[model samples]
Target: MGNKLFAAICYGENGKKILTVKCEPEFGIYLRENYSDITLGYYMNKVHWNSFDLNGNVPEMIIKDMIEQSINWY
Candidate 1:
């Protein structure tokens, strides 16, 4: 899967997830601000990466979009 997004589980923490898509920096900021579940990606560049709570308020569509965006990115 050239889908670079579905890389790996940042850790064994099944509740949170690392970003799979290379989205705009502005969008990443917005996501972290707008969603309580979103945050800077684990051990990654704060400006270019993001992480989210899989069981939080983030809508299913948003997660799907991230996956799709990652597919295109690779």
Candidate 2:
């Protein structure tokens, strides 16, 4: 299977997703088109999200930065 990069804003008892981060396929993911300019993430459904595939095309640091940006999607 192709490696897909996904992310989501996670929530807890506090009632808000404290942060966002890369998500394993099994865990589900979301997407938000307005999140970034170059990159795009979309809402998976109601609560989870995902990002565009890295496809091993960009450098590792860029991917890392994308993950970092996702983490700050709060």
Candidate 3:
């Protein structure tokens, strides 16, 4: 809801049951409402994927954190 990077999904280290971040072209970040669709954004394009390009300025740890966070959410 808030304009910030929130936890999208929570996955295990096993790589199973992956989590996802909702990258809406407008929202700029993921939100709880996105869960309703149950679809991980666009099918072909990663436009809606948990874009590690957050604002075009992201650190490697931040990106890793997003992935880890997603796993936890799952």
| Candidate with the greatest TM-score versus the true structure | 1
Worst 10 residues of 3 by lDDT: 35-44
lDDT of 3 by residue, 1-74 (tens): 34554444444345434444644434324432333323333322355454332333445565565555544432
Evaluate model 1: give its TM-score. Answer: 0.68
TM-score, candidate number 3: 0.30
TM-score (all chains, Cα) for each model: 0.68, 0.32, 0.30
Better of 1 and 3 by lDDT: 1
Which residue ranges in model 2 land beyond 4 Å of their true spot?
A: 1-51
Candidate 1 per-residue C-alpha lDDT over 1-74 given as tens digits, one digit per residue, 9 for 90 to 100: 55255323465275454443455678777877888877777766667667766556888887776666545554
Note the Cα lDDT for every prediction shown: 0.63, 0.41, 0.42
Candidate 1: list runs displaced more than 4 Å: 1-7, 12-21
Q: Compute the lDDT for candidate 3.
A: 0.42
Clashing pairs in 3: 9-70, 9-73, 10-70, 10-71, 10-72, 10-73, 10-74, 11-71, 11-72
- Error at 1, model 3, angstroms: 25
* Models ranked on TM-score: 1, 2, 3
Clash counts for all predictions: 0, 11, 9
